[model samples]
Target: MKKLKIGIIGCGSIAKHRHMPEYHASSGAVIAAVCDINEERANVFAGLYGAEVYTDYRELLANKDIDAVSVCTPNYLHAPISAAALNAGKHVLCEKPMATSMEEAKDMIEAASKNGKKLMIAHNQRFVPSHKKAKELIAEGEAGKIYSFRTVFGHGGPEGWSADGKESWFFKKNQAFIGAMGDLGVHKTDLLRYLLGEEFTEVGAFVETSAKIDADVDDTAVCVLKTESGVIGTLAASWSYVSKEDNSTIIYGEKAILRLEDDPVHSLIVQYANDDTVKYELGGIQTNEEGGQKNSGVIDHFLESILNEQEPAIPGSEGMKSLQVILAALEASETKQIVRIN
Candidate 1:
C-alpha cells in the first residue's frame, strides 16, 4: 500500500511531540508538508521530519498528494484551518477543544460532512488502555451501577512549551479564549464523557486564576457535572499543579469502586463492597512512538482508520459534545449557576 501523504499545519509543541512523531512511526503515512507562521520553525520541523515546509498553510493545502492535514494551531484557529483542509479535499485530524465556540464546532462538523472527508479529534485520554478497559468493565456490568465519579487532568503551566509562561497567548483570552479549561480541562471532559457514555446535562463551576498571576485566563477550574444518566460528578483541571501528576478517575458502583490513576503504572483497581480489592495491571497502553506521558496509540489508530476507511474512535461530532461540556463549565463559572450542556 502506498503511504498516505500528510500535511501538518501550525508546527507547535503538539505537532512536534505527538502528531509528527506518530506520523513518522506509521509505515502507512508520510509527512509530506508542514506549515507555520514562523518560517524558521517550520523549516526546522520540516527538516527534522523529512518533509517540505511552507509559511502559509494555503500553499501546503494545494498539494494534491497530501491526503490529510493535522491542525495543531491555537484554539481559535482550529475550526478555520480544519474547515479549509476539509474543503481542500483532505481528511482532518484536529487537536482538541474542537473550536473556541460551539458555533465554530458546528461549522467544523458541517464542513466535514459537506466535503465528505474524515474528521477526527486528537483526544488521547480516551485511548488510554486502563481507561478503555475500565469503560468496558463498566459497560459489561462488571463494576455494577455507577454511583459517582471524579476526573482530574492537571499540570503546571505550558511554560516549558509556550514562548511565555503566564504571558503566553494561551494565558490571553483572545488567543486561547479559555485557559486551563480549554487546555487540560477539555481532556478530562472528554475522558468523563468517554468513561460514562453519557452527555453532560448541566455544569456548575468555580474557575479562577491562582498560580499564574499574570494570566487573566483561569488557571484553576473545578466543575460539577450532572450527566443525562442522572450521574453527578466533578471535572477538575488546572495548569497550576506543582509537579505532582493527578490524572485520575474513580467510579463508585453498587458492587465495586473502580480506580484509574496516571503514570508510573496505569492500572485498574477495583474494590468490592466487602473490601476485597482486585488489580488489573496493564503495561501495553501506548504505541511504540510514545514517550513520557504522550500516548501515541490514538494517533496510530487514527492512521489505521484512514487506511481502513473506518470511522475514527473519536469523530468530529463526538469531539463537539466534549467541547459542549467544557463550554457549559465556562458558562457555569461566568454565570455562577448551573449551565445546561446542549
Candidate 2:
C-alpha cells in the first residue's frame, strides 16, 4: 500500500496529540517531515514520528517527496503556510478558523484550486459518531424543523492547552488575532453550521476577558446566530469555564430536542416531541489533551479525500464559511448589535 508523504508545520500539542498520532495510525499517510520555528522541538517531533525536521517551513516545503502537510501553526500563519505548500505541489490540511480574515481564507482556496490539490480544515467534530448521529437525525427530519440551538466549547483556558500557557501565542492578537472566539468558539461555529447544513445569516455577540487576569484577549465569548432557515441559536466558546464542561451542543426542533457532549458516558441524548427520551453514552472519534477523544477521525476522512480524490468532508470553503460566522460574531460583540453575514 502506498502512503501519502505528509509533513506537519507545527509541533505543538495539537500536532503531538492529534495530527502525528493520527498520521502514524493511518494506513494512508507517512510523516515525511515536520517544520517548526523552534528547531529543537521540531526535531523532537520528527524523531518521534520518523520524519525529517526543519526550522523553516520554507525548507520543508522544498522537499519533493512530501505530498501533503497539516498546517497546525497559529491562526496568522494558516494562509501563508498552506498557500506555500499548495503552490509547492502538496495537499494541505489546515487547522480551524481557516484564517483571520475571509481574504486569507479565499487565498487558501484559490491556491488549492490553482494547484489542483486538495485543501481541508480539521473540523473534527464532524466525525464524532454522536455528532454524525445528530446530523443524520436532523437531516432525516426526525428532529423536525430545527428551531434553535445552544453550543459551547469551554475549558480552563490556554494556560493548560497551549505551548506557553497564558503566554501562549493564542492570546496575542497578532498571532491569534482573536481570543476565545477564535480558539474555542470557532469549533462550535463550524459544528453548528455543519450539523444544520445552514449558513448563519446574522450574529449578535458579547465577548469578555473576564479571567486570565492580564490577558489582552477575550477569555469568554457568547454569540447568537440567525440561520437562513430561521433557526436562532447561541454559541459560547470560552477558556474560563473552570473545567465545568467539555464541548457540547443542544438543538430544539418541532419533533424533538437533541444534546451532545464529550464525556465518559452520556455523550449524546435526545427527547422526542412525544417525550420519548434516548441516551447514547458513547466515545469520541479522537482523543484530546484530557484523553477524552480526538479530532483525528476528521483528519483521517480528509486523508481519504486526498488518497481517493473524493471531496473533503470539510473543505476550505466550508472552513471559510465557519470563520465568517465567527468573524461576524466578533464584530457584533464589539459593536453590541446584530451583524449581517454577507
Candidate 3:
C-alpha cells in the first residue's frame, strides 16, 4: 500500500511532541508538509523531517499530494481547519475538545460525511496501554457491573506543555474556549465513555478560573456526570495541581474497585469485596508532565483506517458525543443547574 502523506497544521507543542513525531515514525505514513503561523517553527519541523513548510494552513491543504492532515491548532480552529481539510479531499485527525460549540462540531461531522473522508479525533487517552487493559477487564466482567467512578486529569498548567508558555492560546478565552475543562476534562470524558461503553446523559459543574493569573477561562472545573445507564461519577479537570499531576480514575463496581493510574508502581489495580487484590502493570498513562516514552497508537490507527477504507475508532461522531459532555458541563456551570445532554 502507498504511504499516506500527512500534513501537520499548527506546529505547536502537541504537533512537535505527539503528532509529527508519531507520523514520522509510522511506516504507513509520511510527513509531507507542516504549517504554523510562526514560520520559524514550521521551518524547524520541516527541516528535521525534510518536508515542505507553510505559514498558512490553507496553502498546505491545497497540496493535492497530502492524503491526510492533522489539525493541531488552537481549540477554536479545530472545526474550521478539519472541515476545510475534509472538503479538500484529505482525511482529518483533529485534536480534541473537538470544537468550541456543538454547531461547529456538527458542521465538522457533516463535512466529513459529505466529503466521504475519515475524520478522527486525537483523543490519545484511549490508546494508553493501561486504559485499554481497563476497558478489556470491564468488558470481561472482572469488575462486575460498574456503579460509579471518579476520573481526573490535572497538571501544573498548559505553561509546561505549550510552546508559548503561560501566554499560549490555552489561557485565552477566545482561543481556548474553556481552559482546563476543554484541555483536560474532555480527555477524561472520552476515556470514561470508552471504558464504560456508555454516553453521558447529564452534567452539573462548578467551573472556575481560580489558579492561573489573568486567565480568562476556567483553570479548574469539577463536574458531576451521569451516564445513560444511570452510572454516576465526578469528572475533575484542573491546571491548579501545582506539586504533581493526577491523571487517574477509580471505578466502583459490585464485585471490585478498579483503580487506574492511581499508583506509581502499578498502572492498574483491582480490589474485590472478597479481600483479594490484583495488580496489573500494563504501562504508565501518558501525561502532559511526563509525556509518553512510546509513540501513541493514534497515528497508526488513523493511517490504517484510511488505508483500509474503514471508520476510525474515534470518528467525528464519537468526538462530537464526547464534546457534548463537556459542553453540557460548561452550560451547567453557567446556569447553576444540571444540564441534560441532547
Candidate 4:
C-alpha cells in the first residue's frame, strides 16, 4: 500500500502536538512537506520529518506528490487555504471551527465537491474513547431520552499553548474571529450533535471578553441551545479558567445521568434512576498539558478515508452544521435574542 503524502500548512501548537506527531506515527501516511509564514518554525518540523519546507502554502499545494494536506492555520485562513488545496487536487483535513463564516464554510464544501476530494474537519471529540462509548450508550437507548445537558470546555487562554505565546493570533478578533466560542464551544456543539444524533435548531448566548485584558476577542461564552427534538442544554466555553482546564459534560436523562470527564479516574459515569451505577475507565481526552499527549485519531481516519475513497467521518457539511450553531450563538449574544438556525 502506498503511504499518503501529507503536507502540514501550519507550525502552530496544534500542528506540532497533534497533526505532525500523529502523522509521523501513522503507517499509512508521511509528512512530505510543511509550510508556515515563520520559516524557522516550518524548518524545525521539516527537519524532524525530512520534508520539504515552504513559506507559501500555495507552493506546498502545488506539490503533485502530496496526496493531502492539513490546514492548521489560523481560523481566518481555513476556508481559502482548504479551497486552494482542494482545487489543487489534494484532500484536506481542516482544524475546527472550520471557517469564520457560513459563506466560507459553504465555499469549502463546494470546493471539496467540485474537486472530488475528501474534506474533513478535525473535530476529534467524537474519537475520544469515553465520548465514543457515551455515544454508543445513548444510541442504545441506555440514557432513555436525554432531557438536558451542560457541556463546558475551558482552559487558561491560548496564549500559553500557542506557538507564539502572548503574541499569538488567537487573541486577535480578525485572526481568531469569535474566541472561546470558536475555540472550545464548537467542539461541544459538534459532540452534542454527534452524541444525540440531533441538530441544534435555536441558540441564545452571552459572549464576552471578561478576562484577558489585552485581547480583542471574546474570552468567555455561555449558550443555551435547543435541539430540533426539543432537547435543551447549556454550553459554556471559556479562556478564563485560571486554575485548571475543565472539559466535562453532564447529561440528564429519564433513566440515568451521564457524567463525562468529571472525575480524574473515570472518564465517564452513568448513574441510573434505579440506583445502579456504571463507570467507564476509558483513557483521557487529548490535551495540551504534559503527559496528555494521546493520539487524536484524526490523521489516521483522514488517511483511511482517502485510501478507501470514502467520505470522512466529519465532512465539511458536518463542520458547517457545528459552525452554524456557533455562528448563531454569536449573533444571539450580540442581539440579545434567541437566534433560530435555518
- Superpose all Cα atoms of candidate 4 onto the true structure and report the RMSD in Å to 1 decimal: 0.8
Q: Which digits, one per residue and each the tens of the lDDT, describe model 1 over residues 67-149?
A: 99999887888999999899999999999888988789988889989988889999888877789899998899977878889
Among these predicted structures, which one has the highest TM-score? 4
**TM-score per candidate:** 0.95, 0.96, 0.98, 0.99
Better of 1 and 4 by lDDT: 4
Q: Model 2: runs farther than 4 Å from truth?
A: 262-264, 285-289, 292-295
lDDT of 4 by residue, 287-319 (tens): 877633688889889999999999999999999
**lDDT (10s digit) by residue, model 2, range 1-342:** 789999899988788878888888898988999989988989788778889988899999999999999999998999999989999999999987789899999999999999999999988788878998999889999889999999888878877767677678988888888888988788888889889998889999998889877778888888889999799998888888785556878999999989887345777788897879899866743434565335458668878998899879788999999999888987888888899998
Better of 2 and 4 by lDDT: 4
Clashes of each: 0, 5, 0, 0
Candidate 3 runs further than 4 Å off: 291-293
| Candidate 4: pairs in clash | none
Cα lDDT for residue 64, model 3? 90
Give the per-residue lDDT digits (tens) of candidate 3, residues 1-342. Answer: 588899999999998888987888888998989999999999999999999989998898899999999999999999999999999999999999889998999999999999999999999889888889889989999889889999999989989889999789999988998899999999999999999999889899999999987899999999999988999999999999987799999999999999999999899999999999999988787766666547788989999999999999999889989999999998899899999986
Q: Rank the candidates by lDDT, best first.
A: 4, 3, 2, 1
**Per-model C-alpha RMSD:** 2.3, 1.6, 1.0, 0.8
User: Which portions of model 4 show Cα errors greater than 4 Å?
Assistant: none
* Clash-forming residue pairs, model 2: 286-293, 286-294, 287-293, 287-294, 288-293
